[model samples]
Target: MKYVLGHKNPDTDSIISAIAMADFLGDGYMPARSGDLNKESLFVLNEFGIESPELPELNEVEGFVLVDHNQEAQMFDGLDKSKIEMIVDHHNLGGLALLSPIFIRIEPTGCTATIIYKLYKEAAREIPENIKKLLLASILSDTLNFSSPTGTEADKMVANEIARETSIKIDEFAAKMFKAKSDLTGMPISRVVSADYKEFEMGKFNVGIGVFETVDPAPALERKGEIVEAVRELQQEAGVDYIFFAVVDIVVDMAYLIMPTDKEKEVATAIFKGDLEDDVLKIPGVVSRKKQMVPSLQKYLENV
Candidate 1:
């Protein structure tokens, strides 16, 4: 079977969408994850008695289906173009060129699973109970339980319908999922800094950004020195000139941004204009990195 996977540093939405798409495509497609699962994804899979997709070695895989992301930067490095048979994403085009005429579906939805849900409806196929729960989980995650700016009416509508059908309370389940996401008890500083990292091509610069969202910020905030070092190492490893990791407070609408070195701090301050407090920038009312941070940074860089 060919593997269907999402971008690297897979979030709950990325991983869940892969599972849903694989099921939607029927036999010959198995859901896969490009990176290790974060706490939230693990909790959802375990909660629903779903086994994690077997990690496929990219070089050995015959062909693959792309879901949740289409950017080459977000995928395996030096990928063979002919290996891609399909592409489905919710983000902007990233100049992905394929050899053959492949199936491509890109939408401006909150989550790729939201698109997958619509696909089911359009095909007149009844979504299974497990897929419904998984889709609801993914939509809630990517939309921050309908609080994120990325959350659209369709996302909220789909989530509500599944919540009612599966008899799952949205608020309660979201709280539990966020709680599980925040329990980064024993993770190393490196993993904490890169839980949800994504690289964006901003003008002439490749900027790597990671957001760690949690109900309580203490777990990440308490490790400032280590986070600093980790960010430095991670940026170097990613071969990016800039890397910013944000410890987002999900309860309140705030985020504490961390950038390595004085140079990075200066660049970030100029870009975000946030208040620097105790080596971390206090970005008030900024939680969704995709909606609030990346587009702004990309625009700024485009003009520079």
Candidate 2:
């Protein structure tokens, strides 16, 4: 069986892209997730009445197609030993090296679903209504409702096309989706921090970054002490050089970054040119981690 999977700590884009790809590829392909779903992804799946994909055992899959991410650190264990049939991602390539040539589609679009949407057009296949909603949600989530720096005109065009077919207003639906994910009421600090986490290798430094998107930042900020403590624990456990989390206020298009160490704060202030207040930097118009945060940090690391 051919397994279609996405990165671990599955975000909305990662989870939805896996499902959409599996459907597009037909009977032989099975959609799967490498890790547990975040609150946002779960909300999208529930809102659209789509069932969550099963987590696959790496040794059991005959071949695989990766979506959303290509980094081995973000993939399932034992994946390196399996046959990689295809890779469809939107991020920079990492340590994934295949022995043979395979079908690979890596685009600079904001979301992987955008590339998949284009593939649907190329194949002349009609996108199902449910799948259309899923793709729309993924785009909105990854692009921060078209406010993200990573979002492109192609992403807007695809989203508009999908919206017309589904009769879903972009702003209204995005508001509802963001509202659903904003409620992190009972979730533990560790769960909140690890929900949408990702790791990057920046020069000799290992960096782990997490993003928590909410309509208001006050609720998350209220638990600042516990959140910072959790970040420290995570850094120690992962043995990473830097551990950071961004609490993004979707309404105002701002991000409140929590950097546990002084060195991280200095690097962040240098990259974003913002003052750090109590180890939290309030950065304006900095929403996309993939587009802004990661790239800026990588450049800084490269220099130093």
Candidate 3:
């Protein structure tokens, strides 16, 4: 049997793409997750009534297909040792190198689901209504409802097509989905910070960034001290050189970054050139970590 999975710390796109692809492949293919589901992913699955994929026991599988991410760091442990049968992803290739030739489909589209939709078209296979809903939700979540800089026209077109098939109003469903993911009212500060966390190795620094997108950033910002402390604890526990926690206001397209240390604060000020207020820096029109934050921080880390 062939196993399909997404990156560790699986987000909505990763989780949904894996499930959709496995369903499309049929026969021997089985869907799986590399890590625990985040709050947003859980919300999406629950909203759609999709069962979460089983977590794989071994890090190395004989035959496997990866989706949503291509980096070894973001994959399960021992992926490099596994026989990679195929890769369908959207992110820039990182340190995943395979010795043997494999079927690879990496695209510049915003979401892997967009690429998968094209594959279904190429195969002349009809997408089921449930799969269409999953694809649409993944695209909306990854592209931040077409507002993210990483989003492309391809993503929008595919989303419209899926919406038409699924009979889901894009605006209404997206608003409901985003609102469901944003209600962090009673969540602990640690869970709030780790909700959508991702780690990157930049130069000599092990950098960790956590993003929390909401309709309003006030509720999270209201607990600034506790959140900052949680970030500090995460930094220490993870042994990361720098940690950044951002509370993004999806409605206003603004972000408030929380930097726990003086070094992190300095880096944020240097990169954003925004004034720090109470250890939080206000950055307007900064929504995407992949398109905006990661590239800028990687360049800064490389030079400094």
Which structure among the candidates has the greatest lDDT?
A: 2
Per-residue lDDT of 103 in model 2: 92
Weakest 10 consecutive residues of candidate 3 by summed lDDT: 55-64
Which portions of model 1 miss their true places by more than 4 Å?
Answer: none
Clashes of 2: 0
Per-candidate TM-score against the hidden true structure: 0.96, 0.96, 0.94
**Overall lDDT per candidate, in order of appearance:** 0.87, 0.89, 0.86
Query: Per-residue lDDT tens digits of candidate 2, residues 70-143?
Result: 88778876775348788899999886777788999999999999999988989999999899999999999888
Model 3 earns a TM-score of 0.94
Instruction: After superposing candidate 3 on the true structure, give the runs of residues whose Cα lies further than 4 Å from its correct spot.
Output: 78-80
lDDT score, residue 189, model 3?
A: 86
lDDT of 3 by residue, 1-304 (tens): 5778898778889998999899888988889998777767787788788899988756435578899887766777666445678899998777676788888899999999999999999999998878888899999999889888889999999999888877899999888888877888678889889878888888888899999988878888999999999999989987889999999888888889999989998898889956589789999999888888888999999789
Model 1, residue 10: distance off in Å is 0.8
